[model samples]
Target chain A: MVETGLKLCLKQDHPIKLDINLRCQNNEILALVGPSGGGKSTVLRAIAGLYPIQQGYISCQQELWLDTVNTINRPTHQRAVGLVFQNYALFPHCSAQENVAMSLGHLPKNKRLQQAIILLEKVHLKGLEQRYPRQLSGGQQQRVAVARALAREPKILLLDEPFSAVDQVTRRRLYKELIQLRDSLAMPIILVTHDLDEANLLADRLCLLYHGVSLQSGTPMEVVTSPATAQVAKLMNQQNIFVGKIVAHQPKKNISLLSWHDRLIEVGYQSGYDLGERLCWMIPETDVILHRRYQVSKGERENPFSGIIIDYMLLGGYVSVLIEIDKKRKMKLTMSVPLHVARRNGLKKGIVITVTLLTKGIHLMPFESLR
Target chain B: MDWESLLLSIKLSTLTVIFLLPVGIILGRYLAYRQFYGKSLLQALLAIPLVLPPTVLGYYLLVFLGQSSSLGRGLEALFGQTLVFSFEGLVIASIIFNLPFAIQPMQRAFESIPREIREAGACCGLSPIKVLLKIELPLAWTGIISAMVMTFAHTLGEFGVVLMVGGNIPGETRTIAIAIYDRVQAFDNQAAATMSAFLLIFSVIAISFTYLVTERHKKYYG
Candidate 1:
């Protein structure tokens, strides 16, 4: 396992403060996801000893790489951490095999080349060992960079937006190769990326960072389904968020009544919420169900409401429907429906439809946690 | 024509380049990558030779290495020789005069190497010095070669500084420029023309070699 806790203050035109703690076990992929300049890359750099931390400890497999409190900071080369840069920083002058051999510094020159060839074969670059970085395709260069990094025999691997520079087709292939490589080498991997879809596809755990602070970290499902804060829900692309007041709480029944826009909305029970306390809640677009106004029975529709479909977006197999609720205040909710479902229901703009917001789909957070 | 003067010019230029190369690489790499409080001022000082008149620079060196100066006296105590009006003095003056030519290009070459490449080298478990030798220097070969050639060519054409510090003393200090001037003063235009043509051809060859190397470097790496 690799563990890191670091705090860094970068004094640029505007200062950035970073405080984060993370852990990754063997055979686990921990993805750091955030907006640009949110210290996602800085966390990886700190773990690799590229960025010095003000105070923290970093250890991998019982080896102490950094302990700032005791003034123990190993140099980057001395630490057994491999970092694959976004740009694939291969030596432009060195061929693929030579680049990999460069990492095998302890071996004799002949043995180094032999080992580098073995590693290159592992990355599926056997015949192209003599090609320079300029002669290699983007995907091939990235594979060579990975081979070079792995030649160091590091305890953990840090990939910094490894696939951002590749095309979609090549990216899919690289993803498959990366999974195979990860399986063969059971080391902890930390991937830094801004693409949420990529994180969801590859990572075992996700850490969401904002303005240098980690807002939430958990399995991808937990982070998407049960966000810790409203900001995290927004980061996860949850669109339907509203502020409501708890009108009443029925503790024995495990339900509550929330007053939102002249309507009482029934939601799952939440304790420690005082009566009339303001709260923010979100509902994922996928959990929203739409039915023909005449079809949904009155008793089956939990929180059904009729609204005009103001806009709709078609995305291949799915359609996003935007509805303007019929209330004195302006409130719009977005819901996703399968293309077949949308077609069957004749969902279109200007059409009045009924949407049920399921009780289990409404996730609430304290109003004070908005920031 | 004075053949010994031509040979002396070649020897002095060659020895000066050999001495300046290592010094230039170290200083160039340091200046390229380091940041300090007075970094701009230090860079300006290093560039003074590129703009300052050679005679003015030579005069300053003359004063700094004269018998009355402490450094001059210390050297005299150590080697039992005065610095002025000697071949050694010409070497010193040439080194100071051609320093910027050697260092600026080397610095530019070192700077042209991407930082990620160097960081990757370091991440490969190679030390900083090894990274410089194996990765940085090879990648910057064009700049290093250009610097050496320019310094050699600049030193070969030295006249003002050589005359100011090491007066025309036959084989010891009478370089090609000085020899050509003497021939012209004595109304031997034929010998002077021959010497000037030879010097011109030598310079053309050195500059052409530099251009050829740099062009090949660009094509190979681009």
Candidate 2:
């Protein structure tokens, strides 16, 4: 059996080019998370066959939707795909029952109403069947939209920011309903949204898009904890990204040497690579341990570095110190020092500090372009 | 009592509306959604009758279709008929005269509908025709209805074209507008006022009710 990929590389020059390349799993929900105007919705629209593309192919469950080379573009209805639009474009004149029933035009009339009612009931919109779109509130209308899309029993469900407008309580309830569907339906779900929290809650794998390109695509943890690129790191809201250079590929010793400014450090790398390659390294906030003085430690995997705190911010529970290292080029690190230690030591903006970065906590992704 | 002319004018307007409504909708929908060459010229041409003196249009109709011409002969021979001083002739003239009234509102309505909505319909596997039937037509019904009524009412009040080409027949080409003029010229104010009053009251009530129905949809649908 062959795999079907939802692929796109189009630029009507409509804001963003919407270049996405992903093969959705049969049953897993693939959530796309990004900032506003980062082209999250553009990718969703392209997959739905709404946006015209340039030189791309899309196939779902091995069925070809679009093949630019072959000039094959299946009409959207023929695609049998479902979508719960952002605005829930419910037919205003029709009641919820009739609206759901509209999706079942291919079904027999007797079965259409019954099927529509069942789908509506699945979305918890049973009693509101006779109500028109105007009569429904924002959240209620969103549920109806989902029901109508599912009424078709489509091959894949594409939701374009469905819960963006709903209240938090209603959004939570909606997520529960979606989670139930996740366990039951083998139909792949692709939800596009700008909210990271929504992605964390809904997506098994998160795909991030930025300015018409797939910045990163991986499980939520992989993208957040150990992002692959600087763009991915920025999109994931990582505070500290410092430039480092590879020093030694000590394979026998199981420790790769990296130089952070003038200080030499040893960190773990899954593979040994060439030397002098410029790399971007990340020190997660949880990794940095603050100290009262410029202390030295030996016989430990933790590497120590010294710098004066250029700026300090008192967060709720942690103190963030912005440290500048004197290298040939300026290097800044956002080291989150716990507040308890700060209070005990009375650390200030001009205070000289020593911080230890654990070998395990250091993430290294090669930035080849920077060199 | 020139009741036949009055009745004929009402029939003419009614028939014109019936034929022109769909034509207007198709034209409007196409123009609003699709961009092609000479669009501005075509739109201006469609609205020509609204601005041009009806007498000029009537004369042009006669020039191309008068009995003496080969074109007129060809039409007469092809259909065993002529389109001058005939009821069919007046109907044709009225359709052309009131074309813009049927088209403008419908175009505005189609323009107002979001293209994303059409794309949404298309993504649901609705073909262009299906999108038009399901999404475009129903949504644009208010403007369509307004177009029909306005065109029909405008045709009802037409005079100059019928006078130039119609020759005031008793029960055929002589419409109410022509009859009013004829009554006024003959110094028959009573009959003229009677026709005028009927025309005024009927048009006012019809237009008022059309506005009411259209406005009701706007208020309730949103």
Candidate 3:
């Protein structure tokens, strides 16, 4: 069991206080996803011993890394942890092979270079030994950074957005290599990224942080389907956030009936609820179906939400539609169906549309202010 | 106006430069990395020698390190030496006079480096000493060298501190400035001209070397 609770304080103009209490299971990649400057990187830095913590303790595998009361603050070099920087930060002065050899401590002078070569090969950076950082491409530098970190043989690795500097194609390939690396190693790696897709595909457990607080943390599906608050839902890019309350609830059932403002919006949920209790309905964008008329669903099992299209973004691979509800609220839905669905149905702004929330994708989460 | 005294002054300055280079670099690195409550106070203290009257500093050192004091007695007991009226005393006086000239630039050099680079080294599990030896020192070379050159020039050209501590002992404490003053006092204009010529040549070489090194660094960084 791995448990760590830390209060992170950064030295900006005002100290950013992030309290992270997490029990990350062994061998799980816990991805902390959040908005920019939300202290996602702070938590990673604190755990990695790159940032100072003000209060609480960090323990991994029953071994303490930090304890304020005990005053056990092990410096980074002695902590035996691996850290991959955001920019990769491969030494500009050193060659790729030498970069990895730096962490292979106290090895015989001649044997160190050979050992670094083996580690470089593991990262697929073959034959790039003599190449300096400036000579390597963004993707190759990232590989070198990972290889150098792996040379330390750390029990836990911390990566801070390793792919943000690369192009889309390179990022996809690096992500693949990272997954392969994880499978072959048993050490738990904590990754921080803003990409929802990356978080879902790469994480065994997803930790969503917002405004310097861990708002919600659970399995990727749990956080994705039921974000703890409206801010997290927004971070997840949920299609619709309805200001509603529990209209009817079955005591034995986990899900309860909800009404959005005045209209009834049926959703399938598995959380306790009290009737007349105020809450928010989170409907997935993929679950929203765009239609010309309200009869798109044949049966009454359909829960249609009436709204006007506020925006229609025709991205090359997908379409993002923002619907204005009752001329007051907004809903952003993403769809990637055939073009004929919108063209044949004449989907346009100021036009009424009936959308069904794939009930399995719909979730009613309680609302609370984090600030 | 004696030629030998002026040449001897040049000798003392050259020796002074040789001793202060390593000392200044280490002190600069320490001041940059150490974070204590009195850091600012210490910095001001390090810089005071540069701004204070050279005679005042010499007078203070003379009393504290004189033969009558415990420190002077302890030094004599350990090494059988005294600082008064000795070449060693001149070296010590020059080092103190030009210390800020050597350290201020080096401290600024270390300061301009991005903290992330050192942190990156630390995160890579490099020891603090390794970080200093491998990353910090290499990055701060330009400043360190410039500081060395400035210290060398200042020590070579020192007048007031050497005047207070040095009693113009022929071939011992009589530096080029003292030689020039003695010649002028005796109305020996021609000897003064020759000594001035020697000082002029040394100044040109030192100043030109400083300019050349600085230009190369500018081009390299640009």
Candidate 4:
């Protein structure tokens, strides 16, 4: 089988600086994850040829879409791109069927309506073909938008926060639909989203973007569990990132002792760091285990510490507990545990609890302050 | 009622609308979307006739299209007739004087459409022309209709510019408004009253229709 993909390298200075390089193979979905004003949508627009970039090279499926160096930029209409706008952008005056049919100009005029109905039906909008955009619910309008985008039979599909406008329930359903839709698609799909969980759920790979820069691109787990930099860790919502000094390296035990808040903590041996080197480290919430008050767990013997619970919030089936680990420095660690376990242990604010931070879960990086 | 002048008024208004539709659409969409160096200045210039006295616009048109000017001579040479005091010249004057009336509403209508919608049209592989025809024009029809109606009504009611530029050549240039003035000058109260009432009713109908469409558009879009 032939390998097909999209390769894009973009650089700009004024009017929102951007330095990004991305690649996505056919049959793969890559999510550009970032906050607003992070140039995620701008990247999508550039891919669709709806926005201009100062210097870039975009090639997809063995065709050159944009090459600023050679001045070979294709016009938006000339590019085979199917983009679902963040707002859906359906034609307000056109019926749902008409909106999809309008994009099928390549087909025979008599066959367009039939094709539009088939496409709409594929998106689960079967009986509401005659309704205009204003008459459809947000979820239904989004389905119509998806149907219209697919009507073009484009070379690449771009989704700009397609699920943001819908309710949470609808978003979950849409996520499932997209995951199923990905199986039938043979082209690269780029999805721009600000929600990390949505990206992790729907995308095959995640590209963390910040201020127009491509920070990291990898599998969702790779980026989440082992971020390349301290900033990437922070962007991944790692709440226990703390500054620590490497005090001693015990090659015999394969562990490095870190001096954190006047305590020597054993972590996985890191061969690249010098002694007394200041570094940043993070422990994922799932790696923090609360020691049972009555039962002694085997893992509780590793890196055990006592902390006063400062605050906690119940989020669905999980309780996010904030514990102040260092009294004078006011250092805090956020741990998420099952609601039932929290309730079983009577976990609440102002309670002193002992928790174990797994040694293997401690990920270290060069210390740098986030701007 | 001066039936000949009344018919001529309708003819002039219809011709003005027919010519102004394409112009209004192009200029309105352009003004609504593009940001050039002199965009605000151009917009202010387009709006000048709206606030300027009709007689002043008429005076400028007279000089610009009169026999003494080079453009007037070129136009005369091209068409084999001078533009001044002619029906053709009246159409030009009406289009110019009604620029704001024809363009403002349509520009606003085009502006009300979100930018993403146009970009989506392109992303769907519709060319720029198709986007304009299939997406933009359909969305902006109400505003375009309102502009046409306002232009037609305003042309029928215009007196000072018509008198200054076209000079009331009875069948050719004497519109209903000019005939009403002519009737009053001749002390014919019945004809003057009849024509005045006809114009008042027509203006009311045109304005009411425009308002109705505008309100419905607002309600639907909101």
The better-scoring model by TM-score among 3 and 4 is 4
- lDDT of the candidates, in the order given: 0.86, 0.80, 0.75, 0.91
Per-residue alpha-carbon lDDT of candidate 4 for residues B1-222, written as tens digits (9 for 90 to 100): 899998999999999999999999999999999999999999999999988999999999999999999999998999899999999999999999998999999999999989999888898788899999888988898999999999999999999999999998989999999999999999999999999999999999999999998889877765
Tens-digit per-residue lDDT, B7-55, candidate 2: 7977998899999988998899889988899999999999898789989
Q: What is the lDDT of residue A193 in candidate 4?
A: 91
Candidate achieving higher TM-score, 1 or 3: 1
Q: Model 3 misses residue A193 by how many Å?
A: 2.4
Question: What proportion of the real contacts between chains A and B does each prediction keep?
Answer: 0.73, 0.45, 0.51, 0.78
Model 4, A1-371: lDDT tens per residue? 44378899999997988999999988889999977898999999899898899999998888899999999999998888889999999988889999999889889999999999999999999999999899999999999998999899888889999998999999989999998888899989999998888888888999999999999999998898899998999898888888898999999999999988788788999989999999988889988999986678787779998899999999889999999888788778889999999999999999999899999889989988744
Segments in model 1 whose C-alpha atoms lie over 4 Å from true places: A1-15, A292-300, A315-317, A326-328, A368-371
Model 3 agreement with the true structure over B1-222: per-residue lDDT tens digits: 465775677678777777777778888877886788988998899899978998899887777667888987786677677776667778878887887888888887787666766776777678989988877787788888888777876776677788777767888888888777778888999988887787777778877887787677556432
Candidate 3, residues A1-371, lDDT tens digits: the string is 33432222223323786766665654668898988988888887777677777775776655677787788888877766678888886766578998888888757778989999998988888888999887889999999999888888876778889889999999889888888888787777889899988899888888887777788889998888777777788788775666678887654664557776666766665357777888777777777765546354564356666667777777655666766666553344444334567766677666666666666777777765423
CA deviation > 4 Å runs, candidate 2: A2-19, A35-39, A263-265, A270-273, A284-332, A335-358, A368-371, B67-73, B120-130
Model 2 over residues A127-196: C-alpha lDDT tens digits? 8999998899888999888888877778888899999888988899889989898788777899998888
Docking class of 3: acceptable
Candidate 2 steric clashes? 3
The order by descending lDDT is: 4, 1, 2, 3
RMSD to native, candidate 3: 4.2
